[model samples]
Target: MKERWVVVIGGGAAGMAAAVSAAEQARYLGVDCHITVIEKTHQVGSKIRISGGGKCNVTHVGTSAELLEKGFLRAAEQRFLRSALYAFSNNELRALLQQQGVATTEREDGKVFPVAGEASVVAEAFRTLLQRLKINCELHAPVQAIKVHGQQFHLITLHGDIVADAVIVATGGVSYRHTGTTGDGLRLARALGHTVVEPSAALSSIMVQPHSLVALAGAALRGVAAVARAGKLRAERQGDILFTHRGFSGPAMLSLSRDVANMQRSQREAVHLAADLYPQQLHDELEALLLQHSKKQGGQLVRKFLQVSPIGMLLLKSETMPYGTIPNAMVPLLMRQAALDDEVTFATLSREHRHQLVVTLKQFQLGTVHNVSLDAGEVSAGGVALSEVNPKSMESRLVPNLYFCGEVLDYVGEIGGYNLQAAFSTGWMAGKSAVNKLLTAL
Candidate 1:
């Protein structure tokens, strides 16, 4: 049997998975093949090592349908990810990690992480798997360019040139340049006649125009419903939101940042983000409660009224506002926004004032969003267009024996474990497909 060479251009999550899957398939089929993973940085899985603040949210615990509905926002992405995600589901991933001696735990929010609680454990698990499989991994050797020469690929790297029978490019995205993902895969894909969509930030914090909310930095609201509106277009997300000194973050804000960023690029108008502090409460219900408060606690100081009255007690007992009466700090701000003074009592509260308070509470505007930081994005939103790749196998539609996966493909899942799971599944598909193609040719 003739020995064949397989090369993976990146050593991140997708590249590592591709290498492992290819090796497993080759061994199963008794193919004489050698696999090499070329990483430009000094380490492999740099992104995985620092993901989830070092805990490494490995994947979301759910079926493919649930993940598609919860994690993927766009219909096109859901359709493209259907096959790969179902083929290598979350349970399959967990089982593989468990087999490698890495136990995983699931959070209440459905994020899965290594029970060891160290991201290095997940990275090390892959390293161990690669070592056991005898796959050659070359670090600090970046591929400068890839050239096809009649049934072979010549990969020119910093160290030397290597020829391979098949190539998998999983260089990830341009965000996190410190991790060696400098959009090399997109460039590589473009050179091979694939369309590369312009890349931008996703799952990133939105920097808003300076506003009163800056004073409330570090304040977080639970069960908030946020909507990002630009022109006639709008994007909505529901979850907890954290106020930043300059902007907003947390699950809800990060989930909609990509759309906001794209809207900012397409329009000159400023994007406005509005939040409903109590999304579960109706406007009429809140107004009726306020009316009752005014009638019952007529003589109490306006500032102190909500603290001791039915409104506060009602909100406290509600399961949604788990943070305990809206962060005593925001009450004053809310009052100020309603044009009420500190000393005014509920007895003197005008109907106009009551209506203003309801408006402010029901539709609190964060501010005008100026930009979504690409450098700070957890994962970028664009790459080689999905239209140019085969969704079933993750192989390039125009190039034979050439494949793409991970952030290199044009799909950005929401925050949580969706993106990493996409990387793993597509990578496994690409690797398996490449080897199967080789076998067919042989």
Candidate 2:
């Protein structure tokens, strides 16, 4: 039998995983198969190196069900990702890293990171695995186009052309172009008769309309429920949120930015952001707390209870009910919004004043969203439409022997390690399916 070649484009998480899976499968099958990874940049795993502020959150620690519920919010995407996620799970990925001498630690929030605490360690582990597997990795080789010639795939690159029996397009999305992901895979998929979902920014800080909150830049609120509404479309997320000079960022804002971006595209209506400073407290419960506190500490200044330091407030749990805190800087802002004087005490508080205070705290407006930054996005949303690809194998339904995985696909997981996990699982499936297709043909 001839030495069949499998060429994988890009060297990010998905492409590297595909190459490794293909090589391992070929070795296990005792076939004379050669695997090649073509990366446009000089180094592989550029995204991994910068993810999680360089800590490289490897994967989230959870079962498939938990991951689906938390990471994938949409039913269609969850259904599509079920098989791949179950096949090559977070546990299996961690185990693979462990086998490559990369120890991992799970944080209290279920985020997994390298014990060494440097992203370079994780990237180096993949490089070491590739070396041990003896897979050929061609750096500085950017594929210009892929021309199909019957059973063979001719990949035209900047350096030269390489013919392969099968190809995996994991070139990723347009976010972080400096990392070498510049929508090459999306263009290729479109050229090959696949429907491409116009890519948008996901997990990016939102730029809000200029308002008083701009002065509170660097202030943050923990575990707040934020809701963004554009026209009739509404999206909500609960987590930590930071006040930026332009608008807001952090887990909650970043997660909901996807919907904001989509809404901007769908309609011309302005997007507005509102947050519940006390998400855990119901309106009636919070109102009662205010009333009860007034009776107990009638002499307490109104400013004293509402004030939070600029450093922000952490979660405070009492014996029965919990209290959520807002930024100290927000105290004056909220007081102004409620038309209350800072010198006023609970003893002098009127019925209307108390009601207004509660209402202002519950629905604090963060202003309108002006834009979602694609360049600043952690990952790009939208890609090759899921309908054109097979989830079980990560193979293209329209083009045999062609496959896709990672950010190039339309599915976008929430903040955490879900996106990386999806990349690995789908990449593994694609690689295995390509090998199977070749073996059956022979």
Candidate 3:
């Protein structure tokens, strides 16, 4: 009998998992199966090396289908993810890592990290697993074209032509192009009759214009709530917000970016983002405190009252106030109103420093984003439409024996470990299902 073969394109987390699962399944079936992982980059898991700022948040501890489902953009896509995520939850992946000599730790936010806290370690874990399974990995082999004939798929690569009974496209999205995720997989999938969602940067930082917030760059506000509004719909997230030289980043901004991207593309209108610097406090309580402080610091410049809020202090500037003096009585009223609604008058931000404060807080708004740079993003918002693929097997509905996993699909998740976990689960499902189908056919 001829040896069965499964080809996995792109050796990221998804491709690696798919190849391994298929190989393992074939082995159990007493069939000699050749598993080939073709990687465009010189090394597999190149994106893994830089993920989580090199910590490589491998997966999230929130294994509940509901929590994981919240991370995806589409309802059907979220439903499609249930089977795979439940099949291979965070605990299962952790155990797999431990078995491969990679110890992991969970952060307070439920994100799991390798003890080494280096993405390289996680990459090595996958590499070691593939090595042990004797999976054939052809690195630096970019697939230029994919041609389907009958039940087989032919990959025209930079090296040469390669054929397989089953093919899995896990080439990932356009984000972090330096990592080799340059949308090749989406192009290939499109050629094979799959609809490719025009990709946009997700889980990325935003760039705002004409602002001196650069002075406050690197300041981080925890439990900050960001709300993006597009017409009647609104999406919000409460997390840590980090000020960057270009614009805003950290979990809060990344979460909001998804909605910002969608609203920009769909509505053709500029999206508005409002941030609540203090989400935990009630508006009335905050107002009362501000009022009390105003009485205590009566006659003091309004800027002096802003010392109460962490975010307020960062926006204060000396030039905005001539004598740097403000009416103390106005402090409580402004603070209370600002807390209730992010929209505040310029005087409320800093009475003494009214001009700068108003510009910084009340009027501080960026355009609805012309585009998000993919090179700096953590993931892409869109990809091959989910309807064209089978959730059970991660196989293409139009092309038999063709499968896709990872960022290649129109599934994207927020910051944390949800995206990586999705990739692993989907890849595992695709591989196992393909193997099982092959066996049953034989």
Give me the displacement of residue 155 in model 2, in angstroms: 1.1
lDDT of 1 by residue, 27-53 (tens): 999998899999999988999999888
Task: Report the lDDT tens digits of candidate 2 across residue range 1-442.
Answer: 8888999998999998998999889888888889999999999999889988999988899898889889999998899899999989999999999998999999999999999999988888988898999989999998999998998899999888999999999999989899999999999899989999999999999997666587789877876778888778888898888888888898999999999999889988898888877766777777777888889889988888776311122222243222245567788888888889989998999988999887877778888888899978999999999998999899899988999999999999999989999998888888888887788888
For all predictions, the C-alpha RMSD in Å is 2.1, 2.3, 6.6
Displacement of the residue 194 alpha carbon in candidate 1, Å: 1.1
- Residue 394: error of model 1 in Å? 0.3
Model 3 — which ten-residue stretch has the worst lDDT? Answer: 321-330
For model 1, the superposed segments whose C-alpha errors exceed 4 Å read 305-323
Assess each prediction's global lDDT (C-alpha) against the native: 0.88, 0.87, 0.77
The estimated TM-scores of all candidates read 0.95, 0.95, 0.85
Relative to the true structure, candidate 3 reaches a TM of: 0.85
By TM-score, the candidates rank as: 2, 1, 3
